[model samples]
Target: MRCLTIAGLLFLCYVTQGVKHFRLGRGKGGNLGAPGGYSGEKLPPAQWFKQRLDHSSPSDLRTWKQRYFVNDSFYDFNKQGPVFLMIGGEGPADPRWMVKGAWIDYAKKFNALCINLEHRYYGESHPTEDISVKNLQYLSSYQALADLANFITAMNNKYKLQRSVRWIAFGGSYPGSLAAWLRLKYPHLVYAAVSSSGPLLAKVNFMEYYEVVVDALREKTGGEDCVTELKSAHNQITAMMQTHPHIVEKEFRVCKPFEGASENDIKNFYNSIADDFADLVQYNEDNRISADVKYKNLTINTVCNMLTSPGSEPAYKKLAAFNSIILEKSNQTCLDYSYDNMIKELRNMSWGSEGARQWMYQTCTEFGFYQTSSGEIEVFGNQFNLDFFIQQCEDVFGKKYNADFVQASAEWTNSNYGALDIATTRVVFVHGSVDPWHALGITKTQDNDAPAIYIKGTAHCANMYPRSENDSSDLIEARVEIEQYLAGWLGLP
Candidate 1:
């Protein structure tokens, strides 16, 4: 059910063609009834199809094997006035799941049906598999997009939609990637989309992005001392590895179940320490007085917590396997065996890991240190060729992969979504300056056939917040343009 609005009351009778049409205020004895036209006249099947999209076959999900539970209430575009198929970002979050308090109030002003479809292998819709590195190959971005497009067509057929509907796609991070893809793939289906904090660029470079953070620290933090400490730690970690590869291996391999660092897993030690220091700074940016104390407390507490939380058994094993194959044996890794094919496989694995939803491709590559043949555990892609890193992931995780899907995705990334002609769609890309995934924003890249705006210091989807000066001015402009474009199209004021 939606809150009543002025726009809602006025669009009660307007009908679009080649799609299902919904008329407002139509209920029992109110000139409209269930399974009938909004006017309550004996509607023809043709008219019925005009009002709904049909998706009843199980084979619709043949490739994925998950059942599509159709909600009849969901099929009602008439009651809702118009349908706005809303797809969520990746993670365990279902597309049907709505964060009531999180959505923008202004965005909700549009009276439309919102359908949130979950990805194939997350939450209750999980596929029956070992759910380890073994079966992750099935969860590529392309496959996920296919699932969504198929559903949309099915719904259109099921409902007998009266007119070609307009989709305004919006998502942050991974789902943001999907949104950008959808707009590119189905230009006719989507009038516009808002991609927030999503990097359409694949074959990511971790060192490059982390360098941003490192540089940001160096520039903002007043200290050659802190820089010295950082550089010293790096040198120490690197030096410690040559003679102590096994020790480094043992430390990072075991997921700390408890709190403090029991062993000298240099990588784990640093990650734990970093998280604490970041938490302190993020939570209390205004409390500048005890910042140093907070940092010290975080270091002590994080180190202590590592001992308690050593990490899950399976996670440690998987991590260990990665270290063993890719880092410890880089020569035998995908690097030597089949370099070209390996890169394609790497990107696919990014989304198919243990908890696919939480995996941020860019951030993971940037932060998760991988072992190199030099006995160094470095971040995602240290060098320029991202495909090399992607291949490393596949080499590390022996999951079944789709050669076609990988190749296709690689090509798509190379062209920068040029296949979609992003310029053709009335697309609006939004991003936050401080967002970890901000690198995913479409700046310095082709607009995918549309316009883009970046917000400063905002996190993913933070642009939805009401006006605040600290908010992205560009984001504000993009929204205004989006509103204007929609208004012009719908003939609304």
Candidate 2:
């Protein structure tokens, strides 16, 4: 639900705002800071590291090349500076991260070498020939952590680095969890970790995700009126669907007529509309400078303004207008809420399956982060429940991946990783109050060693991005606290 497109899955899918996809720190070319002081004439090229296909199996000697990037522009060989490893998430590893991001800035100041490692099965780091269900068995967080451990060892050998040189892991979103877990699982390998907007807990019914969205709406200006209008609009749409189906179809501009649409199709339509709000809230005021100009300024304030705008037109019409705005900006003609079409897209086992199928597989097999609308007094109706998502898993993969299997998988993940009760030190957990993912993240500090920096009036991974004049004071202070923690761990002044 978090990192899925409507064509690929359901719930929180607005193309760009799919979970950790938007938090890649992608931006225009810029100059590298400090020691080497290189210009943006050429960014770091992608390098490949030979990784084991199955880290747990000694019999399986099969190996594959994993994509990665290295930026040693600020490395001080004489001083033996520390190393910063930025972990890639559910999306591709952008080379710009080597020169950009708050971590890169710290690397420059501390004269540390920077490296970005692409996760296996993501981007071009495929371990197998294809993404078939059998091949995907090797893809899991356990395997990914093993890859990092092996990679760090290989890097240490290649660079001939001393044991004093610290290794600080950095990641956002799912990779954020990886960063934290990397330190917890292999504390001897990783010196410290910065986990930003990382959800440590795995659960089947993530109804709290939508509740945070509603809270974010209320926190923004004119949000109360917008919430009222949105609830009224949903009721109106529901009534029209039962009485005049054609009117409902025309209002939302569905690709197919509602006359022959199945119950699943109707459910998909409601979920799609609800997802628009979820997407907006999840990534509100997050990395907007890199966003498209049309929607770059779009936020909860913008949506509230649109919904609360006074006019003779009904609330439902305003909601439709908002949907049309999104469609127009995305260059889409009609909203395709076809459940069958989604299944067809997910069933594609090709290499170019848009990262949706692979992420969905991870969700089904390991983390059951299905964002459902089963909460009481939810703005979005109860159309998207746990059953809806579980059915999707069965439809896309196989009947074997049913509710029982998913629940068991989630339990396994929590049992193996320790979930919210993860016992680790020198790990800084950073989260934004406005981001819905923060609900599953470590907002409060369990101890002094594992501190939490909960930034107010910010969105997902706000502190990870480069410094902006428009950033909130809390975000700026949070970054400072993170740097201090890293400095203390690295024995810096």
Clashes of each: 62, 0
Poorly placed runs, candidate 1 (over 4 Å): 1-82, 94-104, 128-135, 157-161, 215-396, 399-416, 419-424, 444-449, 464-491
Model 2, 43-161: lDDT tens digits are 78989999999989889899999999999889977778999998866766666666766887789878999988888887778888898889889988999999999999999999989
TM-scores for the candidates? 0.54, 0.92
Candidate 2 segments whose C-alpha is farther than 4 A from its true place: 1-41, 288-291
The most accurate candidate by lDDT is: 2
Model 2 lDDT at residue 479: 89
| lDDT of every predicted structure (CA atoms) | 0.38, 0.77
Indicate the TM-score of model 2. 0.92
Which one wins on TM-score?
2
Query: For candidate 2, what's the RMSD?
Result: 5.0
Task: Give the local distance difference test score of model 2.
Answer: 0.77
